[model samples]
Target: MSTLELECPGCDQVLELDAGFAGGVCRCSNCGTLMTVPVEAGQTAEVVKQRQRPARPDRPMTPGEAEAAAKADEQVYTTTSGREVRVGKTSIPTAQQKKRLMVRTATAVGFISVLAGVLALAGMGVWMLSQAQREAGERTVIEAFEYSPGANPYDQRLANVLGLPLAERVVVVVDASASSEVWLDEVNAAIGAGLTETSSASEVVLVYTNGDGLHMHPSQPRAVARWRADQLIAFQQGVSTAGEGWLDEAVARGMQWLPRQMVLVVGREPSEGELVALERAFEADAAAKLDVVAVDFDSAALDDLTGTYGGRYVPMTREQLVRWRER
Candidate 1:
């Protein structure tokens, strides 16, 4: 049978009736109003229909007469505004969870800290080793500055200044000015003596600053010394050209190689700009602890130049040349 539909007279709520109970009185589902179904003309009084519910096979059924009986059993609390709220029980964390989180965080932090500390120590060790090597190299050169055998008093002092320790790599810059011609032979001897002491050198560069420049390759210090002597002899024979000396260009050329190497300059004064550049160069190589030595005619100017680069200036004596032939 089709269902019957009707609205409540008091609340106008729509309600459905099973066709089996067409002429029935019932309460409205929404407004709870007592309502009467429209009966046939022959029927007089309204009838009430009863609904039968099936029995539950699994569990006992609760009566639906009260609204509270159909709700879940939960704790209800009344707010200050008189509204009730229901809540279920919640769980609290135990000591184990908190301790586990703390341990993991501490472990991560400690691991990172330890790694950083190890890297820092490694860097420091490398720096210390390099410094030690540089100090040893400098000491070797300074110790080799002892007085040569049978050298004159003035020549001996000059030799002390000129006899620098040759490093693994060496750059020898010679001033080829007219005024420098007289002591060129002594300069040549000092170069030879230094070279003899630096037998450990792998490469040697000789630069003569005359007109433009003269360069010699991976040569022996003794060979370059002999060559300088020959050039001096040739100069005495009036075979050399007369030109202004460019010591600045010679120093710049000497610094073209690797940093932290040895440089020996026998020359006149370099320009202030060149002196500044040389200072920066040495400063950059200071970490490597290289040596720079200069022997010049102008003692004061050489002092300033050497001071700029953390090097010392040694005064040259012409008397050194008298015993130059023995070397």
Candidate 2:
């Protein structure tokens, strides 16, 4: 067989083939471009123009070129054995193409990682807010029930001035002056009814207004005593209405125990000097509260005084006291 040398028209690369391969299609070894071999030696090969080939000198075929080459019709040629052989285009990726694919994959993975981190941070913030709210709720419950030791649990009442539950430390100031003699029995009944509701845990002090000062039960300010119905009756039996009493002095003396709440039962309107003295006493103890239960009397000064201290001034009539005692 005669050897033939042909130059590929696509890449100008020289190819050596046998004369038996004349008029047959083959790919150039240097550029992988398909071309038709000539019949004689020294003839230039014609490029098989199945599709426009991309320009890539001294480099591997790009992915686009490889795909185009694969889609082209398969070339059939007769080998030296006289048997027909089929040749199909097969694409092999270049190193640059492999590197670009790896870069794309890494970018996708990095984006997913960042998204997961953001989600985790948002979840943690929600958890922290929930924890704070839970702690605040617990603190509210604890503060609502906080009371002094040995204090009556059943006698607990919400302070109108503080808008909070009162502690076990309580002082009841009764107006036992000559002006309150008419309603003194009703006041004692009301006080006894209230004290009957107290449990053994209660710590109470009864302060009655004397001629010009205040008289406290048990004589000692630091006496830890639980007053019941019997003790309230005994305290009232001992009290005798004589003359006009000093309201300011009685309230000031009630503050000596530093009671959390004080209930004042007054049958007469407070004087200007007494209101001023009451306001001063209230200012002295910011934590202490004064609630006035006015019996058969209502004064704007007394109302304003209780209002200034966040306390309630409730006026009660004879009929109302009767109904309360009956209840």
Candidate 3:
């Protein structure tokens, strides 16, 4: 048996056929096109027939093509196998695609939330550091007024005003007369502050004017001493307001101590006779200078007195003392 080769006219696909089946009709396997086989010069026109193989199921649509077809809605197309395939109307996101998209969206939201929390904490940390720095600065300013151990704000302030480091021979005369009853405690505290600046080798005397006369601690000049609380309490109790105070006598007694510096705590203005006596006492020993602390008392005469003796005059009010004590 001989065979003949022929090309399908519909799709240009070559096919081989038996000579006995010359002029037979056949379908192309490659493209599924049907055509009649041509006859050779010596072959008979047998009009033979051959059954066509069923066209392969239309080539399944590719992923990309299927998506396009679904979007196009009920689109139809001829496949390479010469069969028409109809795509049903289908949404872009199938159940599986929708699930994947939801997971991606949730992950993005969670990441954004975590990032926001981190930023908030960082901001809070910065704010706390700034607050700490601000408080430290405030503490520094408040500490500036304290200069010595166990020293209150009042003591430090008084020390600063008095120009501390007292002279070698110093005398502090406090007025314990009736006029000083209102501010006696403050006067005592002030004297204590003044004594803090005295050196161990320095001589100090404390004098006070009472109804009887003038009273002096130690009765003579001696090295500076820290008075005990009981001693101070006793001294405070001994003050008498029965008679007019001997302020002039007290001043003279302090001057007799021949101190290099004398501090007079006065609660009231001096009388004319007292002033004259003080002037006379100061003139007797011109070398002894005077500094006056006038408690709630403003006296130009005292100011002039301090000026003549080359000393400072400090005036303090009850309100200022109260405020200092509170601090």
Candidate 4:
């Protein structure tokens, strides 16, 4: 027998038996209580099954039996929530039900895709903004445009007034080859970028060369590189800008410049003379760490010289300069 588990809807008492036994009064096993379990009129799975089967040629239900079967066919699956739910083979799914399921699935997928896209865009935006902010916070700027050779130039005059501690110095190298009206501002910008007033110490020097190169600033705690800026400038002013382009010599002169831990601001690639001079200088001193940090103001000219001895090369853009200065 297909046993069914049931409950007394009134007394909360559990009963286990066939639904066919739900005829009238049922005696409760607990508390010796008697209860009435309602059975739908003429409704049973057997009755419903008989109604659905086509009549056999040899045998058929009687008139009353046929009437009871017809009534049973109307029975539905009743849930605990008191809703009539279709459960058997006669309950074919409708087009409306299929359409509703499809719509729900599509909507879920679309919503997830949209959410993922939104998160991806937000992540990318945050990453880019964070990087730009980081690079922008590099260093502070200062003006020491006092390197002009004559008339106690504007830059020199300002330096004298500020009398900036000898510890903080800017070195400007003078070139004998050519005068650079187009590139002077660019070189100045690069050099200015090195000026910082943080816990780290910095001393500025202006290097110059007509035939021989000079590297000088003032007051160093170390015994190395004591060349004075004014004296070097005086020597460069006499260098006839007639034979060579000033910017070329200036870039070449950069390699000859001093201040082991100072900035070497230049316009172009160092000339052959400057390279030979550098090799000889470092070769001769052996233990002398003639550190040169070369910064290229001209973006077109930055490349690894000989694929070795890679010096510090910083390429500055106008926009980057403005952003760096603002910080």
Candidate 5:
């Protein structure tokens, strides 16, 4: 048997066929055009090259011819030895080509998804590590203060505030009069709590209103001053002979310290004059807010001061001191 090759007149796509197919009608696999094969192998001439080829006619063949061709279509060829082989068409995809395309697309999408997941996991891990480091630093400070072992609620509360992103300052003023002696322990503890909360850059002032008034430590690290304050508060067996005039003077001096945001006063309620002194101090520092913890006495002046400063007046009893929780 022999074969013949020719180019279609319409599309010029090369085609091969058996000698028996001469003068037979077939479809062009590239353009689906129905054409008559050349009667002689050399009879048909190739057309000139074209950039844009025209589309095939809507009806490639008569209805009857199309039906007859479909009925006879086998899509396979057989050899004399009875071997069969499938034929190729331009528009149809082979099995191997389809598989390769699917594998490449799947591999690309899968690589992108895995890379995104790994990046997200790394970012989360870094954030968690940073948080743990910060907590560890706070815990070390809490332990150095020598408060009761484990988590002290008071220290933890203070630590939260100290960890605030904004800068903060607190001044503690305690009444050191003879009558305030009974509540000294509670006052000392409150002072210690304040010290625990003061960060390295933040400020804590311990002012004792004994005679004229005493600034125990001026602009010093809270931990160092707090220890010294404990010794001072415990030095005298009873309250000193400080009068209301001395208390007023102490408040006036505290006022001289500028840029105070929060003030804690623990002592007897102020007299009218003493109240005026405190009011003036508050006026001087417009941003200052006052919190008063009454030791043994309470008065309308304390209420008014707390109201004006947007703070609360806490009555400090032994039980109340023990039960105190940070708000």
Candidate 6:
């Protein structure tokens, strides 16, 4: 058997004429340039003057293809006669292409996620602004009422103002004077405003002492206003005094019974001696955390006591005490 060798005219590459390759297009081994192998004799071959070419290691190839060529160049084959042969091959398309597809898919998903987050943030901002605007468009209001008393309208008003819907500690001390019948009207009016019927949430400690520095009912213990309102009023009226002022005496007498609370005082101030006694007792009691408030209807003598002991001294005027709660 004989074999024929052919040269590619386009790239000057060498090709071989196989058994079925004569008279047909054959590929060049060096350049892969197509060349028509001359099967017929006396055929004019198109030729051009070849310039001196620069020495190159191999044909044009990518890194992967060069690695494949290097691997192929390293292959040794034993001939049937025990000889070695080196083979060179061109690279083909990769069979496993899933990795490139996955990378492209991951990049596209990341872009979509960023775009969604931006849109969500903008939507939340718009919703919050809308809610705030709606809230600002709504309404706000407060309710208020007035109180009046017979002797100390401000004190009764103070009771009503402070006692109404009362939440914290509140204690009231009323003087059972000859004018207690008139003063009970003030008490009833305050009850009409807002007083608990049975709840002693506030400790109502009443004073039935008389003027002239006398303890009329010294044996009777202090009682809640809801239960002893009538008794306290009667106790005040029954024990009439001979111009005797028990104002200071009452505070001194009541100091031992004092507890922690905002107090409401009723009736007029007692005589100077009694008033002095009351202030001394209050200043002492204040040290024990008791708040003393005196509501003087007959006279504002209790104002000095109220001021002296840092307790509230409401004037007899309704306008004055009503304004106090407002402020």
Whole-model lDDT per candidate: 0.49, 0.62, 0.62, 0.39, 0.53, 0.43
lDDT computed for candidate 1: 0.49
| Residue range 228-276, candidate 5, lDDT tens digits | 4355345433445364426666666666666344444556656667778
lDDT by residue (tens digit), candidate 2, 1-327: 344666777677556664445566566666776776555542332323334444444767788766655555444445454544444444221111012458789999999999999999999999999999766644443255543322222344422111223344667777888988778887676566545553323345778986856777756332222444576578788888868777888888888888766778788887889888988988999887777778788878888877887666777666665665555
lDDT assessment of candidate 2: 0.62
For candidate 1, give the lDDT of residue 165. Answer: 36
lDDT of 3 by residue, 1-327 (tens): 344567666666456544444433455665666565455611633432222333333788778765554445433333233343343333111111112457788999999999999999999999999898756643433233433323443544322223233455778777777777778776565455554443244567778886777877756766544534456456656765545678788888887778888878788898999999989988999888888878898999999999999877878776666665665
Candidate 2: TM-score? 0.48
Tens digits of lDDT, candidate 4, 1-327: 333344555456556533443333345554444554355521342322222534534568789776655555543444333344332235321111112457778999999999999999999999999887544432211232322212111222222211121223333443433443334343333333222212222334455433433433322222113334354345334434333444344433443434232234344466677666555544543332322323334422333432223233344344443343343
Q: Candidate 6 has what TM-score?
A: 0.35
Model 6 segments more than 4 A misplaced: 1-171, 179-184, 188-198, 211-245, 261-269, 288-301, 317-327
Q: What is the lDDT of residue 312 in candidate 6?
A: 48
Tens-digit lDDT track of model 6 for 216-285:
3324332223444454445445555344335555655556655444344455545667656655765666
Q: How accurate is candidate 4 locally (lDDT)?
A: 0.39
Worst 10 contiguous positions by lDDT, candidate 3 = 90-99
Clashes of 3: 0
- TM-score of every model? 0.41, 0.48, 0.48, 0.29, 0.43, 0.35
Model 4 misplaced regions, further than 4 Å: 1-179, 189-201, 209-259, 286-310, 317-327
Candidate 5 lDDT for residue 181: 61
Candidate 5 worst ten-residue window by lDDT: 90-99
Q: Give the TM-score of candidate 1.
A: 0.41
Give the per-residue lDDT of model 1 (tens digit) for 1-327: 234567677666556644333344455665666655565421322233222333433655556532243233333433233344343223111111112468789999999999999999999999999999767755554454543333433334222315443444456666666666667666655555444322332345666666645544333332222234344344333323236556566656666665334454555566677666666756656532333343345546556646665544555556644555454
RMSD for all candidates, in order, please.
21.2, 18.5, 24.3, 19.1, 17.2, 20.3
